[model samples]
Target: MEGDCLSCMKYLMFIFNFFIFLGGSFLLGVGVWVLLDPLGFREIVAANPLLFTGVYVVLASGGVLFLLGFLGCCGAIRENRLLLLSFFMLILFIFLAELAAAILAFLFREHLTREYFSRELKRHYQGHNSSDVFTSTWNAVMTTFDCCGVNGPEDFEDSLFRLLSPRTMVPEACCQSNGFPGDVSVEQCVSGSATFRRNKGCYSATVDYFETLLFSAGALLIVVLTIEIFAMVFAMCLFRGIQ
Candidate 1:
């Protein structure tokens, strides 16, 4: 009976680690993709450092999970107490960190809303067609998402616009005439008519994009964390049995 239980625990540990390895690979791939995303979807979290930090955290955690999962598999198969103890400690640390992060995310979510994004974006907008990096990034955002200013096209017409480009109310990308695949200039698009510009703002759209990403990431983490906990439990059981 004792031997049978040990065998079952070993099998459970191996199976759990296999799933952990797969989950870690998925997270690692997503983190790398987010870091290299051409569209710059992470810009939505420009105001909050946590969201940006979360990306690196995901990558690091995935790496740890991958390595530790292998270690766990070996420990279970070989019935090594030291390896099992090490796996338990590492996974415990990760579990605590993830729980803390989740709590903080929940607490601060109210401050990271679309209104906050709009306000931050307002501070960065240099004008309709300025040659600054922020301006270019905003232009890319508008073009990619088919949006206008923060709240609308009129959001561009302000003290900022007066200081930069007095005549232009919106960027060329806001206009439907702006050619995305070609070398069309902002001058040509804005010169036509107001009817060509998109009426919707990018603030909501950008927020929505990041919100979806956050939700998916949170769900995945929950699953991975649950797996980690179960693996730890079974590992401890096996360690005790071996002793």
Candidate 2:
């Protein structure tokens, strides 16, 4: 009976590890998506150090999870107590680290506000004519998100507008309507009229973008953590049974 029970746990662990392997793959996919997402990923990366670090951290963790899941599968199938214990220890460390990160995020939640995004935007806002990568990225964000400046049109008042030769009110990207391709006149967009400018500010759009990312990542983390906890429990059971 004891031998039969141990045999049952061995297979149970194998099944559990398979699910863990799938979870690891999901993490890997999300990491790659964030790294390559064309819309606003680059903008976000250049804007905030904390978010930049978080992206790479998630990517690295996904890689680790992939390897650990393989290790777990092998350990469970072969009844290797050493491998199972090692897997358990690594997962425990990761779980604790995630918990710590969560606490830090909650404690510093105030820092993740629109003001923070505005500050970042203003800090990096180069002239519209600049060919720098950051400038281009910012333009792409503003154009794609259909937003202007950080707080509103006023945010750019201090940046590129100040550097303008004749002091245009807004950039072509911030215009409410795209001017005709053949028309080279700046009178339509740079006319210093409220009708030509975008009504929404980049600050709110930027906040929503990050909020969506956080929600997706948080959901994924919860799923992965739950899997890890279950995998740990099953591995422990198998290890004990084998011994």
The local lDDT score (0 to 100) that residue 37 gets in candidate 1 is 68
What TM-scores do the predictions have? 0.85, 0.83
Give the alpha carbon lDDT tens digit for every residue of 101-197 in model 2: 8888788777667777666556666656878776777777778788887777777666644565345767766776645664444355565677767
Q: Rate the local accuracy (lDDT) of all candidates.
A: 0.78, 0.75
Candidate 2 lDDT score at position 62: 78
After superposition, candidate 2 runs with Cα above 4 Å error? 131-134, 158-166, 176-186, 206-213
Q: 1-243 in candidate 1: lDDT tens per residue? A: 999999999999999998998888888888888788657665543335777788898899888888888888899899999999888988899889888988987998876666665665666777555777666767777877888877877676553644566666666768876345663555545553556678788877776766787688778888998999999899899989997
Whole-structure CA lDDT of model 2: 0.75
Q: What TM-score does model 2 achieve against the real structure?
A: 0.83
Instruction: Compare the candidates by lDDT and give the number of the best one.
Output: 1
After superposition, which runs of candidate 1 have C-alpha atoms over 4 Å from their true positions?
42-48, 128-133, 178-192, 207-214
Q: In model 1, where is the ten-residue run with the lowest total lDDT?
A: 183-192
